[model samples]
Target: MSIPGQIAAALSLWIDSVANTVSARLERARGAQQIAISEDEEGALTLRLVSKASKDADLPPVRIGIVDGAISTPLSPEWSAAMKGAIVDLALRPSRFVFRPLELPGRAVEFLDGIIRAQIDRLTPWSPAEAVFHWTPPQPIADDHVELTVVATARAAVTSLSQALLDLGATAVDISTATPGMERIAVHHQRIGGQTGSSRLRFALIAVLAIAGVPAILSIGLGGIVTDSYDAEQQQIQRRIAERRAIARGSQGGPGGSAIELLARRKQTMPSAVMVLEELSGILPDHTYATELRIEGDKLQITGLTHDAPSLIEILERSPHFASAGFFAPTTRAANESGERFHIETRIKPQFGSGT
Candidate 1:
């Protein structure tokens, strides 16, 4: 692929990842209830609330009848309301899926998903795109080998069922199957409506493009006006500088008495707080947060919480604005806190643009 095409693909994948992460976080925050719907051999679905504290426990399981690729009886008002914004786990009968036992070296566990996807056509009648499949977690066996059960079904068979649940107001649906004595294995999962990852990616891309286009349009329209204003100001400053330099040369018999010389000398001696803060912000990772920042003369001290405290020293030392970065206080983590509290001290480079 061309560079632009590769960049576009990367941006799409990143958006999808961010969307999925945000959706997961929102789901957790909302405390969405989980409902389990299990299919029987007779094609009836029994819905049960998975939560132990659920008030709906007193209510009996709702039996759903499916016929001719559609729901035979629509959900009642109460059940439909209960299903809204709820995560539904649909467990189909094992008979509906084709189960194949797969054995491999224990080292292949990390790459199980890719390996299974490559072998899907050989293991089942359906191609990878036409099937929804998942495998059980690898179980250790003798001779450094691991075993797993691959569960799969035709995509067409589950599509209608999942759509029916979505129509009943399920926010998300997960399809799975299990044998009598085996653990349940997931087959497919999807968010309902236009809330899927791909949908979110498209929305994010449009929003980003709209944001970026506004700046470009503004720059194009006001480019000449801004440039002309800057040029006029720059010429005025140059003329004044020349007059001051000529006066200094005539009065003092040499240079080093001009305003620009004084300003440059002061800048070289003093540390800029703005530049220090900006440099630190750019150097720190997202997971790190500073609670205290102190600048006394050329020495800088920072107290913060970070996921990895030891790495901060190396990060600060490598920056051009800081030198001799080291921990002044021992790093510690409270039992309830997720990150380590760190205290670090470093010397700030006082000379402006010296690192360049």
Candidate 2:
């Protein structure tokens, strides 16, 4: 890509990164979310914690099960503590989960999920849109065969469970199978009832939308004013470049002169400030310092500080462009620094105008 294109892409990435960082920080500052997971009395995955209005009102429930190849009691903590205002992850028992192993041609492995989704109505008791399913990583069964285990559950069950959690004030809910010694994959239907979005996040989203919508709005209301502005600027730049190129070609082989050539001829008839500065820079000593320089007509004035101030007149006179070199002001020694200040004036020869 061109340098400008790369720079613009980098700038856009930086902007988006900064915006996401700000949004994340604002969300974190609001609070850390809590989530609880356990099996209920009905043997279904749910966020309904056994209540405790009194000790006799309800004894805290306890259930022990092997999760991820380890024996850990999932119901020891107040399921209510885990469920109150937090994103909940509920790992249902493997027995409760129905796993269907599917074998198909290897070519369909890449799009296996989409294929499964397309056949959801035929494969499961639920419709395509009403099924919540998770599939294991596809395993190669043979040379041309791929095997996958799809875990299917009804979306209505999850929706009902999530609504029940929301009634008890859950932020979000995640449903996964507690398969023996296997890491859970967050399937297509991870979160239900939507995660709570912070106000800052909403504001940032609105700002992003507004920024994205600006060109469209401008095209409609201002009749592409920004587009016209860019086009006009681009045309002006192209015109100026073309004008300069034409002038250069004319100077080489044409007759009618452009403003640049007219300026060049005028410059040839007179001394240029740049040439004088270059000549002065070449002759100026390492320790010598020039503070100010002035030129009027064919006369030049130099104000400087130097170790040997009175010797500059000889140096200036040695150059053919300068003549009648003499001190304009009395040399004064600097008190704190080890240099003498001197002001000199000289006649500038217009013959120094040679572009060579």
Candidate 3:
């Protein structure tokens, strides 16, 4: 390979290695975790180190020790040692950091690191050297644009913190701002030597992979259309054959009209879907969202996600249009932090013209 080609390949391999390392570490950390949660409380910085045990695979975090301004008692030595390879989260008050949002062309996002580094001074109240800034992962918006939340804080504000952490021994350090009712925003982090380079290389690799996958995506899309058309044609032919067979059989067999009328009458006795939906919209909590709703005759099956699923049943049972509101399965946490997935069934109350 040429020198540049070999360099690209090396960068690619390094990027993959770093990603795999971080992913594996995170996976293990989630199972058997120890996080040093640092907070600035009443002008005093405290680090609370905790470990979680997976009891029946549902782990609860146990308090390890509290470090009041970088000092710990009893288990200080244990915590110091543990801090060597542990991920340290330094929490600060919202007033300490300046949060600013920046919108940039999505096309220029590939060079975001460079762009941010260059414009950090202009974007923040401090000089580039004095300010420690970190931009949140770009969120894509309309018109091929992206929005970024840049949190910048003065380095001097946490100078004592840097010495204390390094003295105790910490592998990776992340500084985050904690606000009421909002998720902690990681503003700055200590970078390992290869990580910064790896990030750039990772994006490059993604672009290359996407370009390579374009042809495959196109082929698959075209193939799907052809397959769908063929399937539809086969289905139509099968339906015609079935109808012909039914007609031939109908001449010899008894009429199925009575059975059909009985189904129609049963359908007529069912409750109104619109009334059921209106009741649900009025009674259910704002946080709840239904993913799957199925109505068969008078039986209604609802599968959805919510912050509180148990409360949903009570709300449903209270509604005039619903009865027998209960969960069919256990609720589990959703993929995103949205809430828990719930499966519940209820009986719909029949309305005057609901059956029709």
Best-performing candidate as measured by lDDT: 1
Candidate 2 per-residue lDDT over residues 1-356, each given as its tens digit: 67567545554544544554454444335553534466654464333343223322343334544333233445434554544555555665565455666665455565554567655666667876777787788777654556677777777666565555555556555567644447575432233232233334546666786788778777676767777788679757855765565567568855655665656545544667888998899887887899999999878999988876657888989987788999765554322455666789997765564432
The 10-residue segment of model 3 with minimum total lDDT is 55-64
Query: TM-scores for all candidates?
Result: 0.49, 0.37, 0.39
lDDT (tens digit, per residue) of candidate 1 on 235-292: 5785577456556655674554566555654675578999999898898999999999
lDDT by residue (178-232, candidate 3, tens digit) is: 5433657766555333355446656776788779878997999999999989967
Sort by lDDT, best first.
1, 3, 2
State the RMSD for candidate 3. 18.3
Every candidate's CA RMSD? 16.6, 25.6, 18.3
Score residue 16 of candidate 2 by CA lDDT.
46
User: Local distance difference test, per candidate?
Assistant: 0.76, 0.61, 0.63
Whichever of 1 and 2 has more TM-score, that candidate is 1
Quote the lDDT for 169 in model 2.
Answer: 54
Against the true structure, candidate 3 has what lDDT? 0.63
Q: List the residue pairs that clash in candidate 1.
A: none
